[model samples]
Target: MRPMNNAPLDTDRPNSLIIAPQWIGDAVMTEPLLRRLHARGERLTVGALPWVAPVYRAMPQVAEVIEFPFAHGGLQFRERRAIAKRVEGRFETAYVLPNSLKSALLPFLASIPRRVGYFGEARVGLLTHRLKNPKSKPPMVAFYSALSGESGFDADRPQLKFSDQDISAALARQGLPVSGYYVFAPGAEFGPAKRWPAKHFAELAASLDLPVLLLGSGKEAELCDEIVLLSNTANNAKCLSLAGKTSLTEALCLIAASRACISNDSGLMHVAAALGVRQVAIFGSSSPLHTPPLSDQASVLWLKNDASYQSPLDCAPCFERICPLGHTRCLNDISAQRVRDLL
Candidate 1:
C-alpha cells in the first residue's frame, strides 16, 4: 500500500519513513521501532494519524501506512504542504516520531534524506538527525527502542497481527461470545489524571466472574456505559459496553480475544500489551518509569503518592491533565482490592 503519490525513491531496499506516534499509546510504542527497523533490513513505512491509522495497519513491521492528514494540534500549513507534496520521493529515512514542530514538518518538507528526531519544539533546522532528548524518562519501549540504533534496554514486545477472519468478524460484530471474556480498559485518553475510578472499574467488574468487555472511544461511550451500569448492580456479571462499538481493527480483535485485560494507562493498555494479553497496568497521572507495558506478560499497578495505596501527594506523577491537586489521590487511593489482587 505504499503509493501516497511521489513514488520513485526505492533505491534498492533500505526504505523507512515512520513519523507516527500521535497517541494511541504512542502508536503502540512504535512497535519496537518497527521491530528495530524490520531487524535492520529497514523497509517500514508508517506516517499514520487518521486516529493512529489502525495502529500502523496492524504492523507486520509496517511496509506501508501513510494517512497523516493533520488536525490534532493542527498547524495546517497548507495541510502540511499537501502532505509534503504527497510524500515527495517516497523515502530514504524519516523516523521523526512527534516532537512536534508539526512532527518535523513532513520529514523537513519531504526532502527526507535522513531526518531522524528528538530535539523537541524548536526543531533546530527540522532534524537532519537530531537525537538528544533523553535526560532520564525512558521506557516507551526504551523510548522507541533508542531510535533503532538499538543498544539494549531489551525491546521486542508490541506485536499485532490478527485474522482468524478478523477475530471471527470482531466477535460476531460485538455480540461477543467467542471466548471466556474479561477486557475492561476503562478510558483514559490522557485526562482525568489517567483515569481509574469508574467506580473502581465497577468494583473490578463485580469481582471478576468473567464476561466483561468494556473497551473505549466514542469518548469512552459514557464511560463504558458507567461500567456497564456499575457492573450490573453488583454481580450478574456479563458486563458489556464495547465502547463506541468497536473498530480500531475491531478493538484489536477484541483485545485479541481477551481472557484478561483490565487497563487504564490507555490505548487499550498498549493494545493489551500488544496482545500477549493478561495485562493489569493501572498507573496514575502516568509513570511506570515513563510508559511501561512492553509486557513481560504485563502486571503493573503503580498508583504513586508513595505507593502502598495513597496519602503522600507531593503531586504523584503530576503529569496533570486535570488533577492539579484536585484530590485524585493518585487515582483515588487505588483499591478495588488493589485491582483484585492482580487477578
Candidate 2:
C-alpha cells in the first residue's frame, strides 16, 4: 500500500486537489482516475471552470467542487493567484488534468507540495511529477486514467449517479414523463465537421412515435430549432427544441430519465454514457477508437469502420473542427434509417 504523505496508508485519507478539464466529455472521462484515488483513501476536491463544475457533482467520489470564474483562452494570472490563496495548505497533492501551462499554474501558485500531470506546454517547472505525453492520441478514458499513476484501468467505464428525486424534478420541470421521450443532443462544441446533419436528426425524430427533445447550449438553439421546424413541417413528428433552456444538472437528470439518448460525438454523448443511459453516439470527423463513449450500452456509429461503406473514408478521423475538403461525406453518408435502426 502507498503511504499517504507522512501518514499510515491504512488509516489516513490525505487531502488531494484535482484540476478538472474544461470540456464535459473530458471531465466525464476522468471519473476512473477519481474513483481510483478515492478507493485508495484520498479525499478529493475538484477545481473546475464554471461550465464543467456540475460534472464533478455527479461523481460520488468527489468531496467538493470549486467553480472557477476564468474565461476561455487567455491566462488569468491574477485570478489564479487570488484563488490559490484560498486553497493554500488545504491539499497535499494536486493532479492537473489539462496540459496547458495555465492549468498547472493554479496548483503551483497554491504551493501544493506535489503536482502531477502530463508533460506539455513548457510546464516542466510547474509539475513535480510529469508523464510523457503519448505520441499518438489514446482513448480519452485511458488517457485520464493514467493520471492515477496506476496501470490496468484502461478498460474501466466511467459512471455517474443521480437521485431519483433530482431526475423526477427535472422531468416535472420539463413536462416530460419517464421513458416517454427520446433525447437528441444534435450539437457538437467542436464544430460542424463533428455534428450529424440536422436533416438526419429531423428524419429520425419524425420516425419515432415518442417525442424527441433536442438539447444543447444557447449557441446551438438555432440548430435545434431548424430540426424542430423540419421535423414538424416535413414529417409531422413531435420534436421540441429545449436546447438553451435547461441547466446542466437538469440536462443530466433529463438524460438519465429518458428512454434513450442519441447524440453527435460531443459532451452530452459522454454524459449519457456516464449516466449509463442507452445511447447511440454518432461519430464524424473524430474516430471512436480515441474518444468513444465509455459505456457498454453505447452503440457507436462511425462510417469509417464499415467495409461496405463505398469510397472508404481514407480521409476520415481528420480530427478537424470543419472538413478541410469541404464535403464532410463522413457524416452526410450515414443514413437516418441507419441511426434509427440502431435506436
Candidate 3:
C-alpha cells in the first residue's frame, strides 16, 4: 500500500479521493471518469481494493493508488473509520464508484463535502450528490462517466498507458519476447457460466502457431493448469500456466506485449482492450451490449447475436454465476474452431 497524504491537504488545487470498484474490469471502466476529473485540474487519488489496485496504477491520470485493506461482504465499520481518519481532510470530494452503501461510508465518515455516486442501495444519505440509478443496465463506460456530471459520453472509450521500458523489463523477467506469444485468460471470477471450457482453450492453443500463456488469479490456477495439461496431450502444444505465479502488474505487461489476447468476458479482457491490444473476447452468459470491450482492436464473439446458431440463445445474458438450465449451451456451443478462426 502507498503512504497516505499525511502532510495536510493542499487546498490550492482541488483533489478528490476515488472509492474504486473491487472487480478488476469495473476498475478499468472507471478510467474515463478519472481522465475527465484530471482534465479539470483535480488531483486524483484512487483508493482501491488490493486485487484491483494495479489497474489504477496503470492509468496515467491517477496521482496515487492506495490499496484498501478491506474484504468482501459486511460493513467493516471499524476498518473504514480508521482509514477515514487518516485521510479525513485530504480530499475536497470523493467519488464512490460502487453502488453499495458501505462503499460510500468512508467518504461520508471522512466528511468530504461532496460525495458523488449513483442513488442505490441504502446509501441515499451517505452521498451528498447522487444520480438516480438507471432502470436498466447501461454501458459501463457511460455509466461511470456520468459521475463527472457530463453527458454525450456514450461513445467514450477507456484507455490505459504503460511505459515501454517498464513493459520490456517485465517481459524480460518472464523470459518472454514482445509479441512472441499469445495470452489466454480462461477464468471468469463470476463462475463456470462465463468461462470457455478448458478443453476448448487447449484445442485453441494447440491450433495456434505461437506459444500461449495462461493468466489469472491464484484461485484460477487449477483451472489454467487443466488447460495446460489438456494442451500437452494434444500434439505437445506449447502452453504455459502462469496464473498464480505472476503479479497483476506483470500480467498487464504480458498482455500489453503479446501477439494478441484471447479471453472469456473476464477482467483481463478489459485490460487487454484498454492496453489497445488485438484481442478476441468471448461472451457466454453476459451480453456484450452492456459491457463490451471499448477498443477498436477488439473483436467480440457472442453467440447471442449470431443468426446461424441453432436455437438462438434466448436465455442468454441471464448474468447468473451458474447456468440455471443445467446445460451451458451458451458457452458449450461455442466451439474451439470458431474462436481460433477469429484470431
Candidate 3 Cα outliers beyond 4 Å, as residue runs: 5-8, 235-237
Q: Which ten residues in a row have the lowest lDDT in candidate 2?
A: 1-10
Clash total of candidate 3: 0
Question: Taking the tens digit of each residue's C-alpha lDDT, what string does model 1 give over 108-196?
Answer: 88788888878888988988877888887677777777777667756466887776898888888777777688888888876888888
Which of the predicted structures, 1 or 3, would earn the higher lDDT when compared with the native? 3
lDDT of 3 by residue, 87-174 (tens): 8888899999999999999999999999999988988999999998788968999899999998888767889888998899989898
TM-score for all models, in order of appearance: 0.36, 0.95, 0.96
Report the error of model 2 at residue 84, Å: 0.8
Between prediction 2 and prediction 3, the one with superior lDDT is: 3
lDDT of each: 0.79, 0.90, 0.91
- What TM-score does prediction 1 earn? 0.36
Clashing pairs in 1: none
Evaluated at residue 31, the lDDT of candidate 1 is 84
Residue 176, model 2: Cα distance from true site in angstroms: 1.1
TM-score of 3: 0.96
